[model samples]
Target: MSILYYGLSNSSIDNCTDVDEKVKHHYLPVCYGTIFIIGVVGNITALLVYLVKVRPWKSSTIIMVNLVVTDLLFMICLPFLTYYYSQYDSWMLGIIMCRFTRFIFHFNLYGSILFLTCLAIFRYVAVVHPMHANSIKQKRWGTLACILCWAVAVAEISPIFNQIEMKLQDNKTYCFDLASNNPEFMWPYSWVLTVVGYLVPLVVVCLCYWRIMKELKKGPHKESKKRVRARRLIVLILTCFIVCFLPFHVLRALRIYTRLTPETNCMLDRWAHAAYIISRPIAAVNVILNLLLYTLSGDCFKQAFVEMFRCDRLVSKTKDIVKVAVISKPTTKITHDQSS
Candidate 1:
């Protein structure tokens, strides 16, 4: 994914073909640096707020916590990617790191989509079948669901290990699709990934949310501010998912089509590449936007943010001062202690 972004952007320049040089001096460091700082701080803070302060975890909160962890896992690998890109796509980290990194990327990709889908389904069940939701709203159920999500994600992304291999181009090593040279396998693989990784999951999320919203309108919770906020958050997440993912998938499909055909349409490839480049940043943006959405829409999250920033410190200090004053007595103990 890192290579794709770096190579595609500078594909126009023949002299800048070295992935390591491009990444070392430019691409990898910048992209990885941005992701590391934002992802680490934002996700760690989110996890701490969710776990430490918000102790009584609800089903919804559990899902959000898992999401943060998944994003954090992805962010953890960014430094290696940055180094690889910085070194011009050279995989000095060895095959294990290479495979592990790829696995984590796909794991997060599938895990994120699955969790979002599960969240929508949870909402659907809560709205449309409240009794059923109530029965499975425990922490254990949430844990089980998360475990299943990870399992499925691992199974789905396992193929990436088989498909990805390092190759030397112009005496410089780079990690990219060895499968890209084989259009027959690559096209189908891309299509399958699009369907399983994105399309089907997106459909399920949309449908579940749609049913959930419809039920919400008629249900007893309709008039509550919490319900309103929940609805808005769902809409925000869905909107972010669509906007971040659609262009990338569409461009990928188009690129696959172009690859499978013998006729060279440089124009089409260029346009697709441009779309691919633009979509890469949007994926990271989705991660950052989740924090914004929670901070704005969730009451608990808003309170946690304030506490985390120490905005309440002044008020807390004032209360302590007032307590000290109120507890002070003109009589015995203080005078005795002073004399002693």
Candidate 2:
């Protein structure tokens, strides 16, 4: 989600306040709370399964781990936001924190998507260009690529620092999502984020998956284990793109277009903003869906994930049995004394 969406929420309408603002006040706390809880559990589980269970990590594992790290970082920022929206009138934190918090969300959004794009690219090379896959699949290459993705993400999001500020209006200090003060810059910047951060990666993922699927169909290994993993990976990543990325970008663009245009009816503008509000948290769903992508999508990771969960279940059951035994011992002693 673009940072300024809530800022865009105030809108070009004559009234300083609108329905979007009211909706945001009630909507984001619940959405943020839900995403935060689910994402934390999912990501932490993925982390444990990877860190403790899946040993001897590969290039793809490196990328997936990096993706998880980004999601975790983003998850860390959610509680503060949940609190922010719960008491929507003002920001308890100052501008510096407001800027830092905004930056973390922006960083996670692009970083997770880019890391996911890298996975798609890695799969494309592995399946479609086996001859060169080994060279590109080296651990160092994965590390270098992750470094480059971080650099690019930082450069792309650097502009957000200037766009955001804590606003004091009517004795309330609110940290604006993006300061509405500069529509000239914010409107165009939103498009740049959608294209570079959202659309371009989406196009790349589509092309990669399309080619991978085409190659798999004609190959003899169509039913092979690797092929099955590739197919699953395709489904998971595509779901994320469609559910988490597409709607938010499309709706945000529409909202921006309608807001800036003259002669647009109030109803249309309100609808646009409302749609944008819905899509914002929906886009954040990537952090949750990403847990599936990294675990079930990878070859060794999938096999290991199953074993790890079984191990955890056994451990839990063992603890319960021990607890029961300890309680039974005390009751047996009391009965023996009474009988004597």
Candidate 3:
């Protein structure tokens, strides 16, 4: 979401034009391609695993499935971005497609954040408030939450249609970035985005995990294997937020602030612009982290992956067994929730 915004408009020195086009031209495609490839492969594989093996999804897993879907949604837009940057902001796609891709990217960005927050909260309920968790963490609630997240994210990003425009510059038409050139809309909408979209979710996740940690510290439950795994997953999610999302938001906000504050140092502004650009890809790294969460958070997910890979471990004498396993009709029956 925090992809491309540049230096101040009225800099005493070079302005947004000074924010190295060559670096942006080379950097974005590589980052977008890498993210697209890895996210697509990982999310698709997770979706397949869930569909084929992870039976009877729980509330948390259902949110995770939504996350995978969000990642895939973003993945579909990356190719257009990749091609756009490969030609250095020369948008071959029409204006409608340009705006559509921009919308999808922001939608995925915020949607993923909201879904992750829901995930952490549901997990907190399960770990810290198990007595009431059963009532709160139902599939219906999860489905409703996912729908709400989609609707809210869409509303948050819908204004981009006004902010971004396809403009002609030096005989080339370029689709604007999230950091739109319209000063009227850029900083104001961005500050709102920072507060409501970023900070609110961060605060909620932090609060949920803090309560979970406090609960874990109350007694000998810390020593339990299940609680230990929960602790690990909690740490993982928090790390993704702090390491990936926080820096991006802070740097992007700083960059935008520099753009607004005319008296800002051009050198500092350039550095901040560069830092913000770098942070864009860092935020995208969360998809890989989410893939890790999917594997570790559910025993059925882990078990299915293990079972699928067991064929490699069979010995020469088990060739007949492997053959039978491959050829025989599957007779495994889902008799219960089998979550564990």
Candidate 4:
């Protein structure tokens, strides 16, 4: 989303040509290369650790696994973007690729936010209503909830299918916004996405974590273990969401304001572009952070990593123990025979 914002912002500016194209060409490749490598490795390892090692999945882990999968899917599309930017605003991939890439980008944004919202709600239910939570957090219900999240995300970002287009200029095609020039559509769209994608979800997360913390304070010693774990997870989620998303949304709001006002300052536009570019890498970092959070908060994840790496040693030890038991049985039989 931030990448798209930067591309759109750049397209909006008339004097962008005077800027150093080579710098953009060099920087975008390096930036996207770094993000792609880290994001792919981090998210893939997270998904594998959660799914293969941590079998018998819990609802929280399920949500997290899906989140990692979404992030991975988004990361897969970055190479095309890297190429597009490296070509100095030229898009070599055709119109379909542009639309598909944009779709994946927005899909990750919407899906991740919704899943995080659901995760907070799940925690709230588990902590606030422990007995009822088990009944509600069944596999069937979780599957349904995941389905609903995907449905909502697809529906929300459906506008992009029609709104995005390839712009041709000076015999070069740039994949950017066709609707960004119109304040009538742009401001409302930005606000709607911000509210649905960030504002509402963030409020829910805060409220859920707050209630969870209060409940933990009143619970007994044994429950304290679970509460402390939940609190840490909530804090991690809150921190990631705020740190990664706040700047991007703030820039979006500012961009909308600048669009609505009559006076357009070039300096503000440039700052917005820089903000927009910086936000992309930050968003990618957030995707990677989710994996770290899972490793830290999830017992299953830790146990799985240990077991995965120590499986051969455990197998060898088992074999040695079996051999010792077999030898002792023969000695006991032989001693009995001699005594008889």
User: By lDDT, who's the top model here?
Assistant: 2
The candidate maximizing TM-score is: 3
Worst 10 residues of 4 by lDDT: 1-10
| Cα-based RMSD of candidate 3 | 10.0
Clashing pairs in 1: 19-88, 20-87, 20-88, 23-85, 23-86, 24-86
Which of the two candidates, 3 or 4, achieves a greater TM-score against the reference?
A: 3
TM-score of 2: 0.83
What is the C-alpha local distance difference test score of candidate 1? 0.69
- For residues 1-340, what per-residue lDDT tens digits would candidate 4 score against the true structure? 2223344444555654323244456766787788789889877777777767887776777777778888998997889988888777788878888888878877887788889888889878887898878765666666777888899999888888777777676788878632333456768887888898889999999999899888888836846656667777887888878887787777756765665554556566556555555565565567766776776555478778767678668878999999999999999999999999
Tens digit of per-residue lDDT, candidate 1, span 108-162:
7668888878777777777789888776567787787888888888877787777
Mark the regions of model 4 whose C-alpha exceeds 4 Å error after superposition. 1-27, 177-182, 220-225, 260-262, 297-299, 311-340
| CA error at residue 245 for candidate 2, angstroms | 0.7
Q: Is candidate 1 or candidate 3 better by TM-score?
A: 3
**Per-residue CA lDDT of candidate 2, range 1-340, in tens?**
1224433443355643367767777998899999999998888888888898787777887888888888898987888888887886468878777887888887888897899899889889988998988887678978988998999899988988877867666676777664233556768888899899988999999999999999989948679876787788899899988888888778877776765665666667666777787787888988888876875655477667769878767878999999999999999999999999
Pick out the ten consecutive residues of candidate 1 with the lowest summed lDDT: 15-24
Q: Of models 2 and 4, which has the larger TM-score?
A: 2
What's the lDDT of the predicted structure labeled candidate 2? 0.79
Clashing pairs in 2: none
